[model samples]
Target chain A: MTRFASAQSIAHDIRSGKRSAASTMQAVLNTITQHDSAIHSVTHLFAQQAMQQAHAVDAMVARKEPLPPLAGVPFGVKDLFDIQGHVTTAGSIVLRNTPPAAQDAALVARLRTAGAIPVATLNMDEFAYGFATDNAHYGITRNPHDTQRMAGGSSGGSAAAVAAGFLPFTLGTDTNGSIRVPASLCGVWGLKPTLGRLPRAGAYPFSASLDVVGHFTGTLEDLRNIFYIMADTPAEPEPQDLRVACLGGWFAQNLSPALAAAISRVCAHLGLTGTTELPQTPTARAASFVITASEGGTLHLPRLRAAAEDYDPATRDRLLAGAMLPASTYVQAQRFRRWFREQVHAAFEQVDVLIAPSVMCEAPLLDNPTIMVGGKPASARANLGLYTQPLSLPGLPVLCLPLSNTGTLPLGLQLVAAPGREAALFSLARKLEQAGLAGRYPHNTQQAA
Target chain B: MTSPPFSDEVLVAARAQAMELALPPACVAGVIANTRVLQNYAALIRDFPLPDTCEPAGDYTP
Candidate 1:
């Protein structure tokens, strides 16, 4: 009965004794066991530990003790997040034999403190390097909306779990659109908080300059609630009269008709007639790629030397290339980032939130694995981040909300705001959600296998 | 900045050896293909000029 339920509603159900946490946890595990074979989102299910925690919550409920806001709510984390007693393989075989994590990842610890149970560890691209969650070691995590399409990564499993309703929310890390791209393709709400806005203490590092720990949720409410709980800050008030603009130039190009029309509807609702553009966006995207490759390559250089064969070939080549990149290229990308951040910050001063497409098209079919770019097919793994990569350069907070009633599979739009302006993005997203512009993908219409 | 004149094959071989990473024979082609792609990106960033005062976005605390 708790399957597909929002975290907020589940917590409410447990606190009111409408359902025991044990039963809820059992139901969650059952649903995942039943449905996840199609999506392949889950990697390791902590069945016994999750049941124990759920029973503990039920016991506390019996005592009429004050419950944390999300007590007994089930959630998952990308395999990279440390879960105390488990090895964080980070979707790679190289670390399969490493020691178990000494403690839970910081955000996971916060959620546990608030009574949320860690239900499972989800799949991802090997070493968090690729856009396609087509992991050779873990098996591909298929898009829940359509089993044959990709669930974008390196946070693909986290997003797919939420999209498939296996978990109310799941933790993910985004360096170059990992969260947003998958969240978009999977038809869920994803937040990439301002750089450093949330702790990344235990999430496996990838592109340290760009990595930001965030989460994917089926509902906007859970996205907001869990984010504040993880950030350990009281929620900021949402501004009513917000300045919003849609991004043009690089963002406005190469869109599917449905996504472009959806953007039109939202802009028309806001009475917006003018658009804004970020300068040198293509270069910004390029810079994002170079920096991620270089940093990620450097991080694993030592291991790659000893155990390169253990890595997924799709990821191994990219990491090796990234590792081999010249230092000047890496530095120039960083320098461009500095100038670009100033420009982005200046634009933000005039607007509260900027709207853009999260991914240009709907989920790309796993068989084809390409999207139209300049009227030609391009690799989905490399180009899925076209819009998202440019935004990552400045480390702005971006909220990817699935557009409602779009074409067959789901389409998503990005609500980007100034650094630390997640509240503004949330407020704007809520407006679109209330206006019938955005919501989770309809399960009734899931793509056929 | 001028890029090295060697071919991508040479680049991979030289870099792997320099880093003391013994690239497996099977992995060479894939690595070279990836390197070529990144070089395009590298050229883009290298060509774009910034003010002399522009520094690497090292702090990453935006």
Candidate 2:
């Protein structure tokens, strides 16, 4: 079925005329329409426009014109991304009256140029503020692996769309674990490329310094290929004989037994005997959180003044709190970020990549949304980024690869590298996939039944 | 490191007045709760041993 087909395979088939792009697009649309109710990943389907683009690809093929690498592949974007002539909601109603974007977000335009059709705008947390994609206006995006559980956000819909096989891949933005948290929980491959590596022209902003544009894909190959296309760079060869280390201390603590075993498996496979601790991890995480709140709050302060009532209560409250943060506090967080980045960069001197858990455990149940932190059940929304937020402070590239066959729900591991070192992350992810240690977690049909 | 004692009500009142925000009465309590969370996180950052020469990361120009 086209629903779960990799973007690379879809492009090959379309170019080979094994299937028309129109049929592929229609199949994805039909599948989304039929099955999306259970998961609520999609907020708006670009049916007519997507079909037209698919037809254009077919026409090009008919003329013997060269097809782009991702020709005829359907993908979705987090609702925050501007998709030309459509209003970017950024998962909030506060901007509902704002004019439609005049152009596609930079990455969306790049992907379109590479022949990938944007099929839908996916769900996300209001203003991309929450880790859980439980939107006050749009409703929650349920985990496909277990519908009763969460699909992590504000990129939750992007990850869920890929995890549920609705699209080959989807665009998302990460500022403090939006991409990694959801990708980990939903059991798909996601990448938060090095900060500023990919342009962010029209993606709605949150935490300017920390915001990174990236994507989620069903397959590692798709993730790698689309990443180059979006980054507008040729694939760099991954270095062989790369040094890797596991992150210990704060990262090693408060993990579920299943997650602990999964990390151990990865470590044993790589013959990693010792762990490298990032200096002041708890402070790193706290600094990241402070920066996010301050920046996001400041960005929305003007609107918050005018129409705070129009915002989601959860998001509005956080933004309000962020707006109230003293300037000294925001400044100090940025100072800490600079220091933390240097410390993290120094750690790379000893290792090419650092391995850490994407989340402490699997997706928390929606009915009882809590994750264990320090031997107590903590609010899932507040603590889900326990691991990811610290890493964000350094602006390093992190590939969130889903752990495979853990005999439990999906767990994800972060393969992290220094800035502009995504190749190493990709290389390590490929190795893990080959070793049967990392890959997409298949949707649980038994659980659904 | 201990943070200086701060009043949530005072901070919220000043923010509301400065931003000209019309926060609903219902939202104020939630905002205050979240403000406390921010305060705690801010304390952590404030306590980090950063030297004065360490500038905030600005536009990166290679």
lDDT of every predicted structure (CA atoms): 0.92, 0.90
Steric clashes per prediction: 0, 0
Model 2 per-residue lDDT tens digits across residues A1-449: 68678888889889999999999999999999999999999999999999999999999999999888888899999999999999999998888899999999999999989989999999999989999999999999999989999998889999999999889899999999999999999999999999999999999999999999999998999999899999999999998788999999999999999999999999999999978899999989998998899899999988887788888999989988888788889888888888888888888988999999999998999999998888998999999999999999888999999999888998999999988999999999999899999988886542110
| Runs off by more than 4 Å, candidate 1 | A445-449, B1-4
For candidate 1, the per-residue lDDT at A186 reads 92
Whole-model alpha-carbon lDDT for candidate 2: 0.90
lDDT tens digits by residue: candidate 1, A1-449: 87679999999999999999999999999999998999999999999999999999999999999999999999999999999999999998889889999999999999999999999999999878888888889999999878889999989999999888889999999999999999999999999999998999999998999999999998999999889999999999999899999899999999999899999999999999979999999899999999999999999888888888899987888898999988999999999999999999999889999999999999999999999999999998889999999999999999999999886698889999999889998899999999999998888633222
Measured with C-alpha atoms, the lDDT of residue A15 in candidate 2 is 90
Each candidate's chain A: what TM-score? 0.98, 0.98
List of clashing residue pairs for candidate 2: none
List candidate 2 segments past 4 Å from native: A445-449, B1-6, B18-22, B60-62
